[model samples]
Target: MTGQVALVTGGARGIGRAISERLVKRGMKVGVGYSSDPTSAENLQSEYGSDRITIHQGNIGARGDCERVFDEVINAHGRVDVLVNNAGITADKMLTKMEVDDWDRVVQVNLSGTFYMAHLAYLHMAERGSGRIVNISSVIGEQGNAGQVNYAATKSGLFGMTMSMAQEGSRKGVTVNCVAPGYIETDMVAAVPEKAIEKIVSGIPMKRLGRPDEVARVVEFLADPESEYITGQVYSVNGGLHM
Candidate 1:
């Protein structure tokens, strides 16, 4: 993967940060996209140097912002060989209590934002006859959480998009795959109450929360040049929680 170029959305923090650092260590030049938190982005740049990493700030929910970020990455690195659609947000509330704005905002960022980035990368990759796209989903999307109807729906929607895009990209030497991560030790998971987290961990066969790097390893595998045969598949990094 040395010398390859990749764009990782939400790459400044949490699991995205792990992914970005992993890819950079693997010898790939990465474009780190973040909506906020310039400090984290700056830290990554400082750690990896500009030669291996570039940071872009934008709201993935907006098509214009997505376009600008994508263009900036292309202009900086020449081309994108891999795209990791890891940006997402959660507005948790019971179905009845969830406001229209909350639902719309989640959908806009999780689903529409992914589409915008993937569409741009897909076109470019298909034309170039080679590329990889990895979408970050969640276990809640598979099991359907009580207070996360909107989030679950959007995450689950990635399945259809990934599979369909995989078929289309097949002949073009591009692959699309999804990674559904369980309760990992991310800021998002940390926000969960301690009691709730305990219950969540007990249910996992592994009896522990997953690590961001563990999920990043799967992503790295999928983005490898040798992973060409794999596509339209979902790799659950949930420690047998759902299997």
Candidate 2:
């Protein structure tokens, strides 16, 4: 994958950050799409070298921003060979109490954003006859969770979208797949009440929260050149939480 260009949304922190770093270490040029946390984004750029990685600051929820990020990456790297849709947010609320804005924002950013980016990247990949896309979904999407109707909806939406995209892109040699991570130990998971966290860990067969790097490694495998036969698949990195 040396010299190939990869774009990772939400690449400045957490699982996305780990994916970005892992890809760079494997010798791929990377474009990081980050909405905030300039410090982390800048650090990635500095550590990876400007030629190896370029940080594109933009909100994935907005179509125009997604366009800009893609344009910037192509302009810098010549083409995009891989895309990781890792940009997402949680708006936790019971269905009745969930505000309209909260639901809309999560859908816009998590579902629509993935669609927009994938559409654009698909076109480019089609022209080149090759590409890879890995979407970061969640276990709650498949199993469902209380107080997370909006979040669960968006994450589940990714599964259908990935399967469809994989079918469409498979004929063109462009692969699309989804990764459903369980209770990963990230800042997002850290916010859960200690008791709830304990309950979550206890439920997992591994008896522990997963690390971001564990999820990142699964992404790496899907994005690799050797994964040509794999498409329209959901690889669970949830420590057997979902069987």
Clash counts for the predictions, in order:
0, 0
Cα-based lDDT for every prediction: 0.97, 0.94
lDDT of 1 by residue, 66-85 (tens): 99999999999999999999
* Candidate 1 CA-lDDT value: 0.97
TM-score for candidate 1, residues paired by index: 0.99
- Candidate 2 residue runs with Cα over 4 Å from true position: none
Q: Model 2 residue 185 lDDT? A: 83
In model 1, which runs have C-alpha deviations exceeding 4 angstroms? none
Report the CA-based lDDT of candidate 2 relative to the real structure: 0.94
Deviation in Å, model 2, residue 188 alpha carbon: 0.7
RMSD of 1: 0.5
Provide TM-scores for the models.
0.99, 0.98
Alpha-carbon deviation at 174 in model 2, angstroms? 0.5
lDDT tens string, model 2, 1-243? 887889999998999999999999989999999997899999989987898989999999999999999999999999999999999999899998999999999999999999999999999999999999999999999899999999999999999999999999988999999999999888899889999999998899999999999999999999998899999999999989998
